[model samples]
Target chain A: MSPSKSPLIAVVDYGLGNLRSVSKALELTGAEVIVSSKPKDLLSASGVVFPGVGAFYRGMENLRERKLNSALFKIIKEGKPFLGICLGLQLLFTFSWEHGDTKGLDIIEGRVKRFEGNVKVPHMGWNQVKQTQDSSPKTKDLFQGIPDNSYFYFVHSYFVVPKDKSLIAATTEYGGEFTSCVCKENIFGVQFHPEKSGPLGLQILKNFIDIINDSQT
Target chain B: MFSKRIIPCLDVKDGRVVKGINFVNLRDAGSPTEQAKVYSNENADELVFLDITASSDHRKTMLEVVKATAEQVFIPFTVGGGIRNIEDIRTLLHAGADKVSINTAAVENPKLVKDASWEFGSQCIVVAIDAKRKKSVTSNQNPEWEVYTYGGRKPTGIDVVEWAREVESLGAGEILLTSMDRDGTKEGYDLELTRSVSEAVNIPVIASGGVGKLEHLYDGLTLGKADAVLAASIFHYGEYSIKQTKQYLKDKGIPIRL
Candidate 1:
């Protein structure tokens, strides 16, 4: 079958994976998705998706093992539209307190911490996300047309606590208002699984695809 | 605030969705993928597909059903029944399942819960408990429920609350609590059994079984204090839609996503 003219979205597969659902969801947005471990895919694609589940340390280790770590940094540095989900979002931070102190990609200035107090550990199920205001056009477009405080599916024990509060794109209440989304220029990371978030989640992915299509010009 | 989830469970047997009344008298609903899409489009928070096929050879059929559903239906779904090992969990996850629920397997070897949780994170491990209320001499006596396995056909003799606590310690992210007596009777969820287990575990407890109407769903979340409610007959037979249930819950002052 001949390839469509849609923008190619490369989903980084570093072994700490949920590659199938992520890629399938991306494909649903009419984008050509390539689930690959090769750095070439990341560099060549119009946009990149760094989706993951499981441990932050294990995710980083797998990225390093496959030599996709530097490739990811290069893609972000090159101003390519990038989106991270769940652990993928956590992997962008400076370090995490999960298990022991584990260093992350340091792409964003933040520390990942576990939920404390009366809150549930996983923070699972549907929760409302309130979008934050930022001057970045990309940040605004990320949640464009999507209503503020819309419910998104979340399932994570640790959340990113970014040092630069301005980078936070959205916040959700659990224990007490943790960062649900982070945006810096073209880099976007969401704590919830947009792929599993139903229609609104599909809308979020469609927005990301729109961002990618808009960036091509 | 986190919204209470309303899940519609589909029991798939030989690739079709079926709801067995008390684990027998099976009634065919429709295709697994079709029913899943309907529930998803209706905005059900999550979906659970329990493979009730007795033969192990039909596992491939279930996998195909899962793959098809994952491709079309874009909601978080959990697959359960006969998931006995790590490979079963891994295969289901690879097929695009968000979580896997283990029942008989987890009871036989509690290590599977620890190992699966360690390998794939506790967030994806859901321990399903099918419990039956034990006979009590007097109304003043403290009530007790015993865990049952093999589609509620065999009793494990293990106390429900204690087992729930044990699984939570074993790293289960959530518990799918089903009351055997209330499962098909439609007398509403076994509130006592649900509350006991919910109070025992810190992780989320999804109250399942015996949901006949919108009020039952409300009762499960309010009185039972379960994080989520799962029902098959009400949804499978189109007695009530997820939207109606959520609206009813919302009207009744329960936090639900509509």
Candidate 2:
């Protein structure tokens, strides 16, 4: 948050993850990124990000083994804003139904379920998200100046269904109305991979950084 | 929905853009970089640079040409020709090329497609297939087509339809299918070839070769179901600027960047 010191953000790297791209994107925003599997780095970081791809159970197992679970909970409890992407977002739910039952961070009440129907399993490519419940300051805060119905790059089949409908920030339609992003107090999660979303996606990251900058000030 | 794309393909040989007749009668089009700049200024939606000589020459020179072209052009550019491994893809990507196209190398070793996609995201990888229709020797041949490599010189004996699906599953984000029979003919794209490949794959299909007039471009998009139309002869010989072609398409209610 200090103008002179680069904002140090810890990207949780738990052996099986997409650490490099998440780190690169943060670096593009002029933030000092420290990719760490260590709990100590997570405790000391000003901002924390959980960027992941691939299966749900494996991602949770890696996070739990590395003890990132407790550290992340503590960081969020301290009201430090946290962002989760894809499996990162799915990890925040109470449980995921992928490859059997897998417990999540439980920061928000939700469950991840596989997309059902005749369509492709992995809902790939760009899809537009329709924003809902604009009352929350984080709504305007996280989305920033991006236009309504702006498309974000997506590559996932399972989506988050928040227990508290109030927590839902945006919804996108593939088979039906599914949660694309959710915000609860200091925590934020997105089901889409923003780094690969091109310019519009970069703006979302910029917005998150701006929020961090403002909160610290 | 996104606008349909009009792409100008520059087949580069020895760092210069060149055009050939059915993969022969090679003539210099211009400097690859210079030609790219012209396309960029002319409002071309995208540019494709095929290192036509990748198999015949050292790989480093192709990278150099890509580096130079990337420096001059701002719009998205896809580079192909002689990309053999992940390192080759990485080199071109680091040089500022938006996407890397793998053809012969992918057909030679199918693993290259998956490896490249894993190393760099699938969006950055494209598979270029040069296809030609086989004359019916017997009625039992099913009137099918075969895939050709080394600029349509060597037949792979692989069915064009089946190979397209395999590459798409291997995480190729798009397919650049060129019809050798239609190359330099200026009649139109091989609609049968384009439609078959487009239907076979879920990813975006780019129709290449035999684009003569604006209507041919339209046929590629409307009839052929190609997401993009890639032409060289029409654009290279100054028969039409990309802007004019785009305007023609747009006037016909086909979405295109003006």
> Which candidate leads in lDDT?
1
- Candidate 1 residue A87 Cα shift, in angstroms, is 0.5
Show where candidate 2 strays beyond 4 Å: A1-6, A12-30, A35-39, A52-71, A94-124, A133-135, A155-159, A175-177, A191-198, B1-101, B111-126, B137-143, B168-174, B183-188, B210-218, B227-258
Local error of candidate 1 at residue B111 (angstroms): 0.5
- Given candidate 1, what's the lDDT at residue A26? 84
User: Could you give candidate 1's per-residue lDDT for residues A1-217 as a string of tens digits?
Assistant: 2234588999988876467777888888778999999999889999999898888888878888898888988999999999999999999999999879999999999899999988767899999999886537777778877888999999999999999998998999997999999998899999999998888888788889888888876
Residue pair clashes in candidate 2: none
Local distance difference test, candidate 2: 0.77
Residue-by-residue lDDT tens digits, candidate 2, B98-199: 678998999999999998776565667789998888886377655578999976889999999999999988978788998989988999999988999987
Give TM-scores of chain A for all candidates: 0.95, 0.94
Error of 2 at B147 (Å): 1.3
Two-chain DockQ for each candidate model: 0.75, 0.09
For residues B111-195, could you state the per-residue lDDT of candidate 1 as single tens digits?
A: 9999999888899999999998888635799899899998899988899999999999999999999998888888899998888
Look at candidate 1 and give me any clashing residue pairs.
none
Off by over 4 Å in 1: A1-5, B20-29, B136-138
